[model samples]
Target: MPKPIEEIQKEVVEEFSDLTDWEEKFQYLIELGEALPSYPEDKKVEEYLVPGCQSRVWLYPKEDSGNLQFLADSDTALTKGLIAILIRVFSDHKPQEIAEASLSFIDEIGLSKFLSISRRNGLNSMVNLLKNYAKNPNV
Candidate 1:
């Protein structure tokens, strides 16, 4: 089974705690970005677009046996990793679970502290998109 979000947050905090500087944090973000799967070019347009992001983003959601699954792609590497992290936390959950998760969990995971203001805003936008989808999957 996949780890719980709390466990994942703890792991990420512990794993990266040694990085004491912003430069190191930025490097780590890039490294995380490297692990994200590529988004197909065709899917990067229209309805999938995430506004307020510096990079192009596309998110597709599907329901499987009462669970929600998200497939996301971003033009910017760091943004892609950010989406990957979100997917790891939200995917495979029931729509109610996804919708009910506190957006403050981003800060609990230390993502807000390490990210730029714009990046944090972008991340919020992404989370909002997912929550909206969870609330209205047929839209």
Candidate 2:
């Protein structure tokens, strides 16, 4: 079984807490983005494109036995890392859990304050996309 969403968020917070330097945090995000598996080219269509982002981001949702899984990619490393973080917390979980998640970890890790208004809006859009998928898988 997968860990609960709260537990996963706590883990993310713990991971971010170890990096005191902002530069270190940025590098870490880049590393996280690099760690994601290469997204399939075919899924990079308009239907999967996330809006409100400065860069291109594509998110593909798949359901397996009632659990939702997300495959995402971004043209920029930082945004890719942002989506990776969301995937880590939300993927492989039940739709209800994902739809109801608070994503307080973004605040706990100081990421929100670091983001520009546009990037923040993009992040919100990505979260909304995932939540929409959870609430209505046909989306």
Candidate 3:
């Protein structure tokens, strides 16, 4: 089984604790973004586009053994990293756990301070989508 989301988040926090600077955190986010797989152009449809976002977004959730796994793609580079962060924080969690995650946690991570207004809005949209996916009974 995969580690719990809280453990993953703690690991991320510990990994960056040595940096001790927001700029370094931002650089790390960018690096994470660089590692995200590119979204296929064919997948960029209205159904996948997240509302209130400046860039296109696609999120697909797969449930495995009562845990939710997310596969996401975003048009903007930073948003891809935002998705990566969300995946780190929520993926492998039970649906209830993912649904219960506090959106304010992003602010605590200093993500909002580093992201532009548009990117922040995009992040919000992404969070909503993820939460909704987690809450979906059909899954």
Candidate 1 lDDT, tens digit per residue, 1-139?
A: 5566566666666656778876776677677767766666777678889888877878988888888888888778788878887887788888888888765556754788878899889998999999999999774
Q: Is candidate 2 or candidate 3 better by lDDT?
A: 2
Candidate 2 Cα errors over 4 Å, as ranges: none
Instruction: Provide the global lDDT of candidate 1 against the true structure.
Output: 0.78
Task: Report the lDDT tens digits of candidate 2 across residue range 1-139.
Answer: 8999999999999999999987888889889999998899999999999988888999999989889989999999999999999999999999999999998999999888998898899999999999999999754
Can you write out model 3's per-residue Cα lDDT over 74-138, one digit (the tens) per residue? Answer: 76666777788888788888989888766555655667787788888888888888888899935
Model 1: ten consecutive residues of lowest lDDT: 1-10
User: Each candidate's lDDT (Cα)?
Assistant: 0.78, 0.92, 0.76
Deviation from native of the Cα of residue 81 in model 3, angstroms = 0.7
TM-score of 3: 0.82
Models ranked on TM-score: 2, 1, 3
Q: Worst lDDT window (10 residues) for model 2?
A: 130-139
Q: In candidate 3, what residue range of length 10 has the lowest lDDT sum?
A: 101-110
* Predicted model with the maximum lDDT: 2
Q: Name the lDDT value of residue 102 in candidate 3.
A: 69
**TM-score result, candidate 2:** 0.97
lDDT of 2: 0.92
Model 1, residue 124: what's the lDDT? 88
